[model samples]
Target: MIDKVIITGVSGFVGQNISRYLSECSFDTEMVSLRNSDWKSNLDGIAILHLAGKAHDTKNVSEGSEYFKVNTELTKELFNYFLESNIRDFFYFSSVKAVADEVPEVLFEAVLGNPKSPYGKSKLQGEEYILSKQIPQGKRFFIIRPCMIHGPGNKGNLNLLYNLVNKRIPYPLSAFCNERSFLGIDNLNFLIKEMLQNKNIPSGVYNFSDDEFLSTNELVQIISLVLDRKNNSIAVPKSIINGIAKIGDFVKLPLNSETVQKLTENYRVSNQKIKAAIGIKKLPYTAQQGLEKTIKSFIK
Candidate 1:
């Protein structure tokens, strides 16, 4: 059992939620942010879950260099400090993009990592650093590469979709067909807690995703269900939508090129390894159930 824990990026969405869960379970939790402050010596024997890093910025090209600095360089610094400080466990939250931009039709643990974006490359660099290090006796390290994580308070593209659906705005994405795996916050929390307690989970990389995959249309339906609105989606031809997105890009309109790509892209990550290691068959929530819960939180 972990008595003391240090959570980096505790102010962010996932970090804040996980910290609350740990605190409620009677673990002594300390919040740390990369933006400021020094660590207290009291964290000497604690387990560290590092969640702080530069998220992928879709709009800006220059932010790629910054991603490398914060994601790769900062992680190296923290790992070195943890090794010297006698920390027992170190959990690094990486993204699935580190492995692949678009999950192959048949995903597996041994897939060759070919990251297209700088965000993915930066995370891959961080994972490589951890893998290259020699683990001292009594120390365990984990590199968790979770797919698109969504739940209450998530402020990304998922939230934007929820807002549009909730407001009964017509969706022009029905023509697209893509299946993507999403990680619910509750399931992710369960896996993290399992890692904290289970010593047998080998110190290495693990991929995570929900059991059931949902297409974009299904996701929008779940959002509509949560909002008690009619499931109204138009099957706008792909060519038309693409034209609109192109125009929106130049006009600086709301549904710009980036949003269009996100809606149409398919990223289906596999979580078989994590399930086998943790010895679980199904997560606590279904795709629709988890999504509904997330949407309901926004209404309240």
Candidate 2:
């Protein structure tokens, strides 16, 4: 029975979602900011969720050093404190990008590749530091590498897609086929609750995602189904789309090459390890159900 927890980065999306979820589950949570120096004094809890880290800059405007300063350095600092404290479990929220930006196949816990971006590199450094240390007998450490996490509060590519569908704009990249995995916020909270109470689950690196993978076209269809709107996907030629993306590179347009690739990329992540460890055959919500719930939230 886990009573209390200390969480950092409560201001972020995942932090806010998890904080509220845990509170609803009757667990007392203490929100702390890593920017403060006295956070060490507030570690009177069963676990510490280190969620404070710089997010990926899609515009490529952020400095490379900024990634290290927050994701790598702060992680090392807080982890050092955890090493000396009575906190029983340490959960570090990492990204699948920490392993590879481009997944040629399905990603698992053991896949190792060079992370192209600074954000990926910094997160990998944090994971390496936590694993390099020898944990105390009673303390457990979890490194969670979640793929694209989406829920009610999230505003990202999904929101854009929903808006486009609402406006009756046709999806032009239906020609490209891709399989991407998504992690629902509810599913994530459920897994965390399991980890908190079940000490039998061993501590290690786990890939966090929904049980199934969905493609962008399928996502568009799901959005349409949720909105009660007709699917407006048009199979535009790949060559023409690539040419338009090339033109978009120099102009201020929505469909850039990067954006197109992000929409149509095969980045499937496996949650088999986590499910097996938690003794669950499936997650609480299916991929379509979770996505539809999120779409409904957008309407609200």
The prediction achieving the highest TM-score against the true structure is: 2
As for model 1, its CA RMSD to the true structure in angstroms is 2.0
Per model, state how many residue pairs clash: 0, 0
* Predictions in order: lDDT: 0.84, 0.92
Regions of model 2 farther than 4 Å from truth = none
The sequence of per-residue lDDT tens digits that candidate 2 reaches over residues 1-300 is 658988999999999999999999999999998888777775778999999999999889999999999999999999999999988999999999999998869998998847999999999999999999999999999999999889997856698899989999999999999999998899999999999989998889999999998999999999999899999999999999999999998896899888898999899999999999988899999988889988899998
Can you list the residue pairs that collide in candidate 1?
A: none
lDDT of 1 at 168: 81
Structural similarity to truth (TM-score) of each candidate: 0.92, 0.97
Candidate 1, residues 188-281, lDDT tens digits: the string is 8888888887888888888878888889999888888878898879999989888988999999888777888788788887788888888888
Q: Relative to the unseen true structure, what is the C-alpha lDDT of residue 175 in candidate 1, on a scale of 0 to 100?
A: 95
